[model samples]
Target: MGLSNWPDICLGSLTPLLPEDFPIDEDHEFKPDNFYFLKGCVHFKNTAQILDMTNKVKKSRWRDFSQSFLRDVDNAAKKADEEQEKPKYEIKSCGEMMRTIKTMVDGQKGEKICELSMTFVSFDSSMVRFPDKEHSRHPLEICPVEAGSENKHECFVRHSIPYFWDMSSQFGTLYKCLNQKRVKIASICAFGFGKDAVLAIEGDQLDDVCALSTCIILLNGRDAMDH
Candidate 1:
């Protein structure tokens, strides 16, 4: 939530974070034809105002912001001492996550690549009652899949979140989680009027009902997914 350039609240706190729109899922999958993937590096920095130090650093604004986090033993001790009194200028600008993400997105370097699958499905029939299943026999649901049934839904990129909140001094693709082994996951699909029904197989139940305010956006195909 640091609000310097983007968030604009407190400026960069040097706290590594997921991309603003991370863990996001879209109703449609990214067209495999498009095939867009982002891979990059996570440069750590010791300072926050990367823009200000660009000239002194002799590197891109992003690099200064990320690589400024220092690893020198002496630098670490000094930073710990400054924790007693929080200063507006003195922030431990550790910039690994963002830097790595940027690099990955920029097609440079990464331990993992971020990719999304998008697709569009249209109803079999042009006009019909939404989700009523009044016409269950027909494929014309509210939204139509371009192809046929199966694989009609959209899915988005999903990955387990690393717990960097702790300053345990862990390093490199290292974060403890209940399920830390799973690298990437794809989830979230389907969109429609409040009353749309997805066919469940063999006694499985599928129903999603959100509050009026929340469903309002969903009904209109407005994505308000949280990262």
Candidate 2:
């Protein structure tokens, strides 16, 4: 997509914890100004076309939003049971689904600034990740919807990060305050593609989020093998 067609994105603010709600050193004096707040954001380079897909879907998650491809699979599964009355349910394989995602983003980028894809294992899903040459999958334990539902449903993106099996597990979550409420909107994690290092992010709106810091490191497996 051209710069003119790109959408405008803004940073979401981080929420502060109350003194009583958070643990603090009782002996030391609490400096409210220094300790009470944090702010962050992320921006894609002007020359690059960023396509980030993070897996934020819950296995037990209620079907909330109906996007294009998913709607097809969902509609077929809900049809009548009779053979003649039943709708033809051609299961959309996971690979096909990923291809669809790839196509949509790739179309927008006329030139290859960064044709990177990051996929992650969905939370609470029983599906296994077979080895793939270009995607990373991690199985997250099933978590209750209520475990952390204070955030708005719109605050997270449902796509999975496409990182292959060779990546590191250094990942963490990002929190922000939206409309007076505290919510987690993004997550950062690492993947090892062969000996190459890759970074993955999970969030509702990536462009608007701030980046405190970013560093990419490439490791030499030959040295480790010698040890």
Task: Report the lDDT tens digits of candidate 2 across residue range 34-124.
Answer: 0000101111111111222122222232222224323332333233222233211111111222211111112233321112221222222
> Which one is best on TM-score?
2
Tens digit of lDDT per residue, candidate 1, span 1-227?
A: 11223321211124423322233333322211100000000111222110111112222222211333212212333443465422112112222321110111111221222111111112221111123332122221122222243332211111222211111121111111122222211111121222211110111111111111111112222121111
**Clash counts for all predictions:** 37, 25
Angstrom error of the Cα, residue 197, model 2: value is 7.7
4 Cα displacement, candidate 2 (Å): 26
Off by over 4 Å in 2: 1-107, 111-170, 179-181, 193-227
